[model samples]
Target: MKYSPLLSELISALTCLPGVGNKSAQRMAFSLLERNRDGALKLSAVLHNAMEHIRHCERCRTFTEEPVCEICRHPQRNESGLLCIVESPQDVLAIEQTSSYQGMYFVLMGHLSPIDGVGPADIGLDELEARLKKEPVEEVILATNPTVEGEATAHYISQLCDSMNISATRIAHGVPVGGELEYIDGNTLTHAFSGRRKL
Candidate 1:
């Protein structure tokens, strides 16, 4: 079916979003036009505003309207000389949801993918090293994803921390709380076994 120029343009723009295909874009377009026009308008306004105003926080690389993000500015979030390094703002959000971490953070935004031309500088490692030198950082937490690139990034960061004499630790990855042994993969099982602790 041929869409009007405006509809066709909307569908094309929507496909720019990750995982949004032509069909999904069409469904979204129709849903907004037929059932949620007001929501669509509000979303457009917010998207435009965010695109214009959102920037990476100088302190942690998280998206923020100000120079420093709320997490970096919160008085209760005093660093205590510990910093958690993650691959993206989403990882920071996931860790924050656990209410477990109590220190500061460094968002890499991307993993180390040499084949893709992403390197230490591309992911803000130099900046992180500078911060570590300036601050009395006692520990560096490697919280990057459990992918090959994530592992490489974590290893590089760990080496940097070692050279600086700061202890580096990695977040444990293993079977989920409700996961069963039968369904577990070999890599996860190995990690779970290697990271096991005594009762």
Candidate 2:
């Protein structure tokens, strides 16, 4: 009638994933056990390995096995004085999928949310400032989502850039109001990046 403690624990752990309720977890556990044990084992192993080995890139803050992520390491990528700031690594992927942006990226890791106690420093603002000073970026593009928090974050960064005499810009209107960068289509993202306006 009841699963073993180990099996139950596995199901419970699976439920920790976003949108995975008890029913979904139960379904997944049963499917993993019944259909593909080897695949499940491989998945677990990969998860463990990634968790252990992956780290934030020193320059961009994207997760990678190396000290710097592939994007940061790529010699062909436009290291030619362009930086795109985003909210997360997923946003990096979304923009990359467009294949339009050749510039380097800076991941904020999170947006500024005072109510939730998330501040600029909490999301690596100091590092961003330091990087702007050290790196020769001609343009800094704010590619944060079109949400309230995202706008606020972008505004804060833009002001900082102004104070520091850095050329800062915000992506144009392709991204819907209150929409997330992760959910926007590649074409839209490309358009937004291409049509960026000075902040």
Candidate 3:
């Protein structure tokens, strides 16, 4: 019932991943050791290389090995003059997957959570403000999540945009399309009602 020290260490390290608990980590470690040592070695090498080389893009703060991310380096992104603000690099990937947006992004890395001692500066708001001042942004799209912290962060950035006479818009949050009203939460229902568009 006892794993070797290295196996135990591997399980513990795997547990550091989000949603990977002790049992899941143990399963992964055992699978790698028992059936795929070569694959495990490749994974370790790739992960180590990524950790060593990948860093935040200077312009948008998204992950990249080069100085700037591919999206940020795209000249048309600057020409679009629309900057979509998001709370994490994952949000950028989600938006890109849609292929509907062609503008640039500013990844906050996190939302403002004062209770947890997270502030604007901690989430790269200062860098965002500087970008707004220096760049020729026509509008800022606040694509933060619908959580309380996300709303607070959006409001703060909106106010900052107002001070600089820049247009700021928050992405609408409401009941999902095809979702029945009866099953929707009151807050989502209210948002859907208020955010209704003309037919």
Among these predictions, the greatest TM-score belongs to: 3
- Model 1's TM-score against the true structure: 0.93
Query: Candidate 1: which stretches are off by over 4 Å?
Result: none
- Model 1, 1-199: lDDT tens digits are 7999999999999999999999999999999999999999999999999999999999898888999998888765654777999988998989999999889999999999999999899999899988888877888999998999999999999999999999999989889999899999999999999999999
Tens-digit lDDT track of model 2 for 120-199: 99989999999988988889999999888999999999999998899999987678889999999998899789877889
Q: Show where candidate 2 strays beyond 4 Å.
A: 174-199
TM-score of each: 0.93, 0.85, 0.95
Model 3 TM-score (2 dp): 0.95
Considering lDDT, which of the candidate structures 2 and 3 is the better prediction for this target?
Answer: 3
State the C-alpha lDDT per candidate: 0.91, 0.91, 0.95
Which residue pairs of candidate 2 clash? none
- Model 2, position 52: C-alpha lDDT score: 99
Per-model root-mean-square deviation over C-alphas: 1.6, 5.9, 1.4
User: Which sections of candidate 3 miss by over 4 Å?
Assistant: none
Which one wins on lDDT? Answer: 3
lDDT of 3 at 5: 88
Per-residue error (Å), model 1, residue 115: 0.5
Q: Would you give me the overall lDDT of model 1?
A: 0.91
Clashing pairs in 3: none
